[model samples]
Target: MSKMYLELAKRNLQRAKVRSLLAVIGILIGVMAVSAIGIFGESLKAAVLQNFEDVANELIVSPNFQEGYKYLDEKDISRIKKLPNVAEAIPIKSDSLLVESKKKKSYAVVYAMDEKDVEDMFKAEKGSIRLKSSCVVGKRLAEFADIRVNSKITIAGREFRVAAILEDTGARFDINPNSAIILSPEDFEKVSDVGYTMLIVKAESLEKVDDVKKEIEEKINSRDEKVVVFDLKIILERINEAFSQINTFLMAIASVSLLVAGVSILNIMLMSTIERTKEIGIMRAIGAYRSTILRIFLMEALILGLIGSAIGSVLSIAGGYAIDLMILQDASYVFRLSTLLYISLGFSIGVMVSVLSGLYPAWKASRLEPIEALRYE
Candidate 1:
């Protein structure tokens, strides 16, 4: 029965090649919108996460102070280390300063992560620890700042040799606004005799991140003389939430195009049904069951959807590659495979919609009386 139904469906589709083609195109467009959004979201997330890990582990601890820098000190670092799921704790300070290397110059965020902790967090070809008189350069910063390996640079009247150059890892966030400079704990002390500002903490896994966060938060909240400063994770979360809303808006806008496609599909199917009213009546008169007639029309819709979606999906893949190229050229990030999965899923959704949209038209076509159809002919 299924095979016979499929054959009838195929024949009907073949009879209206142009209309079927247009319906498929509609499905393809809807799927393509989904694909583009999915690719951007996943790849951007990966790039951001890579920056997060580059800091340390799965977690970070900031002064839980209710005030500001006044509430944070070295003591918080020690306490955070004792918290559950925290394997290591390191103090870091990052601030922007005026810098000059030879005649070249830049204003950059100078990081003060623990030499060993930063070393453990990331690997370098040369040196991770800079002597009190030296520092390291991030890849993008090095290129932008135009400094060479082992070259000497001065920040805030303190001169230091460029002890190492970090390799490229697509860590735009960690780079801290497109430019970042690394300084060892010793060098950090040179900048400010005051206590360190940030604590780098590592967790066992993603599961442990929240636990560690809560542990550190409660510990800091207990202290009486503290000023609250936004922790890095909280700030990052706020940023992520904002992006998610933007993504939602983008999807909502893209849906307009999908709706247009849906209407196109409806119109094409309706027109096809009207033009074939006599034929529909003849089939009914010849003893075709309503169910078979419905199946035949629905199959045509489904086939059209599949064709369009497949084409759109292929085009989306190509577009993703183009996007990847543009990102690499601009920010050194690339799309991941999960992004493609989203594209495929989007196409499938389009296919499902195509089938659904045809139901009413198909049912209408199946109900024609043979006598009336012949009389009209």
Candidate 2:
């Protein structure tokens, strides 16, 4: 029975190929618009989360700097270490310097930290970190500079060997880690001032994060000291909130296309009902039930929707890639799984819109009296 209904639906749609194609095009456009924005949003969220994965369990303390340029030094680190629930306080110093390879020159953030403290944080894509007088180049920095293991690069007028190439971290805190250079504290001191820019503190456990943060603030005691505490979880939550608002706004804009598609479906289905009225009346007279007639018409709409959605989903991959290239400038940040899921969602929405839009027309066709429909024709 289902097969018969589907066959009838197929035949009916086939009789008006051009009209069916146009309706499918309308649905495809709607799905594509919604899907493009959804893919971009998911990609952005994934990039942010991936960038923070290594540091999500850590808290950052930096200068409030409301009054003047204040620095976080060893003294503040010592105080924070003594606080209850504290685990370790590691200081990081950062400065921007010109980096030059044989092929290219780029400005890069140079980070100075205790190599032992951040040993586990480094994921090498090409080589290894040997720590003294050697620099670990980020994935992007290595690519941009066209350097690799044993490649010599000059930074801040000092020459160093590229001991390792770190894996690309899709996002970063202040500077993109994928485009940064890591060095030991002592080495960095030789090139620039030893003033610490920030402190990374590990809590005894995730539960102790808030307590550790408060104690550090109390120990620092003043904005003059330039102490500002940032909880990673709170930062993540805020980012999620901001992106949620952005996603909603983007989806609203995309939904306008879908509304237009729905109207197109409604008009097409109504016209189909009028054109097939005599045929419907003949079927009713031949002992076909009203439910069967309705189902057949609804099936036709579903088929159109499914075809449109399939095409749109496939094209969304290209659309997503274009969006990433134009906006994100890197394919590394686009989350593949989430993108596929969003495309599937777009397809489902397109199908649902088509079926719902066909409802009234299907009902009206099912209601046509056999005698009146046949006599009119």
Candidate 3:
């Protein structure tokens, strides 16, 4: 009986082929808009997150210059190492110094850290990190100064060999080594007597970053707020939250298209009811129940929704890929599970809106008086 009604509904839709096609196209556009926008947002978020993965579990502790503290001391490092969840607390001394390489002079930001800390914190692109009486050059510095491994450079009139060339690490809050130089503590003292400038604390795990940061703040800044601890996890959370709000805003804008599609379906269903009124009256006169008339009209709506949504789902894949590539320069995130869920969400919404739009029309048709409809021209 249900199959017979669906067949009849299909036949009824064929009566106004152009109108049905328009309704289907409306739904297709709506679904495509919602799914594609969602996928694009997800891909953009993924791309942004890749840059922070390396530093997420690290914390930067810098002296509060507002409190008159010029630099971090050995006491601060000792206090931080005793804190819970801290894996390693490495002190760093930084200053700008004149460097001469191949007679081309330029000022570069110089860092002084323990040899072991340098090995752990940075990766060598070409040579090994051996900071004895040697220094490691950043990728940009190496290229600008025309220096390579074992090349001698003068730092404040003191000569030192380039031990390694560090890989380019993009912009970072803790340290940007891409345009700087790193040297051992002994070499730094010979050039300048400045103390440690900051400390980079590595947490035992990603989940413990907050705990480590909190402990450091409570202990180090308990009295006078002498130092500030920067939690990268908090920064990451704020970034994720920002992206989430953006995604929601985009999805809301896209949803307006679906609502417009729903309105189109409603208009189409209403028109269908008006055209079939006489036929409906004849069916009523032939002992057809009101519920039967409602079912037939509803089945028409269901069929249209299924066809439109199915096509939209298939097309959304291409749409998502295009959006990802255009916006993020990467299409890999489009295939993620989160992105696919957006497509399913769009398809479900299309079907639900179509059936709901048909409700009032089906009800009106079912409620028409058999005798009055039959007498109408």
Specify the highest-TM-score model's number: 3
- lDDT at residue 311 of model 2 (Cα atoms): 92
By TM-score, rank the candidates, best first: 3, 1, 2
Arrange candidates, best lDDT first: 3, 2, 1
Model 3, span 63-152: residue lDDT tens = 899989998878878999988899888889999999999957999999998898877778999889998999999999899889899999
1 versus 2: better lDDT goes to: 2
Question: Please, what is the whole-model Cα lDDT of each candidate in the order they appear?
Answer: 0.69, 0.83, 0.90
Candidate 2 TM-score to native: 0.66
> Which portions of model 2 miss their true places by more than 4 Å?
48-54, 61-87, 91-199, 204-229
lDDT of 1: 0.69
lDDT of 2 by residue, 81-150 (tens): 8888887778889999888899998788998876776466667888777768898888887888789999
Q: What is the Å distance of residue 223 in model 1 from its true position?
A: 4.8
Clashing pairs in 3: none
* Per-prediction TM-score: 0.73, 0.66, 0.90
- Considering only N, C-alpha and C atoms within 3 Å, which residue pairs clash in candidate 1? 65-227, 65-228, 66-226, 66-227, 66-228, 67-226, 67-227, 67-228, 68-227
